[model samples]
Target: MNEVLDDPVSQTMIDIHCHVLPETDDGSVSLEESVEMCRMAAADGIKTIVATPHLFDGVHPPPSRDDIRRKIDLVMEASGGVVEIVPGGETRYSHEIFQEARDKHTRIRLNGSSYMLLEFDFMMVPPNIEMTIFQILQAGLTPVIAHPERNARIQLKPEILVGLIERGAYAQIDAGSLLGSFGKECETSVKQILRAGLAHFLASDGHHQDRRRPLLSKAVSIAAEIGGERYAKALVEDNPLALIQDRGIPFQPEPDLAALRGRAKKKAAKSWYAFWR
Candidate 1:
């Protein structure tokens, strides 16, 4: 059993998605920055952090599994074990993902668990996304969609994510989104997702120690107001711990799909009425 499981109070928060690996991508730029980010996370009550650098984003070359593992060790050593750092990647959606799934790529999985942190384009959902998710599931891995609330397409039609959740995919909301760092549209969408119980994890997509620093307490407070304390805590603590352990999310509640659909229709009707006015 994970040590955290033995002492729930000690491991009160676990961040499953973060870009804390120095120089791996666009996250922490140097070893000093990575160590600072770890300290920030530990100070914010995050006991465990999955260092998810970007992968297959057409920007940085994908870090090898050994590279990721080695970087994690470096960060952990530099940080003096302030927080437990684990290997993972914020994998961009691509045809290559299918092959990765088939091979059960450990580097892309969170802490080499069955859970993969999947990222889509910010402006659009990928073509045949449901089928893609199905393929990932069929390969015996769960795709945890990262920051769906910030996606332009999902913002316009929140119910689109409901369908993905129903298809066995989980959603992770960025801590910054909850704190309104992404703007009003993202904040509103994240609240709707939380209230409807569509969000399965709350992660700090922290890229730097100062700007998008690793923190979850502020967001968890806002989430508690939107979905109550139990659900809010589950997003950052129980759910994430379960994910890294390759276990089913213990706090998952049936998403209120009907509510999301209804709200979308109402918004559409209002937009149409305003168009004529």
Candidate 2:
């Protein structure tokens, strides 16, 4: 079990992306598991957790707003309110998203805010991703890209994510990735993203209480090493809290695209040299 950090910042942590709702998707398997997950989150100092189940992923049918709310209520009650669980979904990129975005009462939006957690395929970024993000923005919702560092395409070319951030989409790095839970490639990409100021939020895209646990202290410490304590706190605390409140992110910084590009070029050159040598 990961011990909660002693820092004051961890006490008010807000996890904007977590899958803890019972039988909602591939998250907590049952109501008991949901309660346990909430306990785990609270122990780790997560005061609030947005229960983001998978949505419009072509696998599970879209859960109705009432169903999500009911599940949230159940978990909150069962856990004795150990942690505040808000309603949200990790919506996959699809044509159906535009329609949901247009709806005033769309359940997919995070905590009924204009922010939405947008997910893409793991293997590739869609070719029409820019246009899709534009449409979502036009619908008055900010798309927070979930775990771009885990994407194969972004791992190979992080500047692609820079373009999306430039296009007004925010990037969220998974806590697990920072701790090398996803592997070295993901860890490298996440560090590069943070160093270049490309990430706006850090969250536990936590699915299980044990495997991908809902803990952020360890990862936040790692982020503090890479980008200072203030910048790291903004990712897990200030920024995400602002997001759930439907306010502008207080810590967004312009990504250093020039620096990122230069690094990419150097890495390519090094790879070429190693190949020849």
- Could you tell me every candidate's TM-score relative to the true structure? 0.93, 0.94
Off by over 4 Å in 2: 1-10, 273-277
Weakest 10 consecutive residues of candidate 1 by summed lDDT:
1-10
lDDT of 2 by residue, 3-82 (tens): 33233234589999999988888888999888888777777778999989999999988789999999999999888887
lDDT of 1 by residue, 51-131 (tens): 898999999999999999899999998777878988888999987787787766567888878999999999999879999
Residue pairs clashing in model 1 are none
Best by lDDT: 2
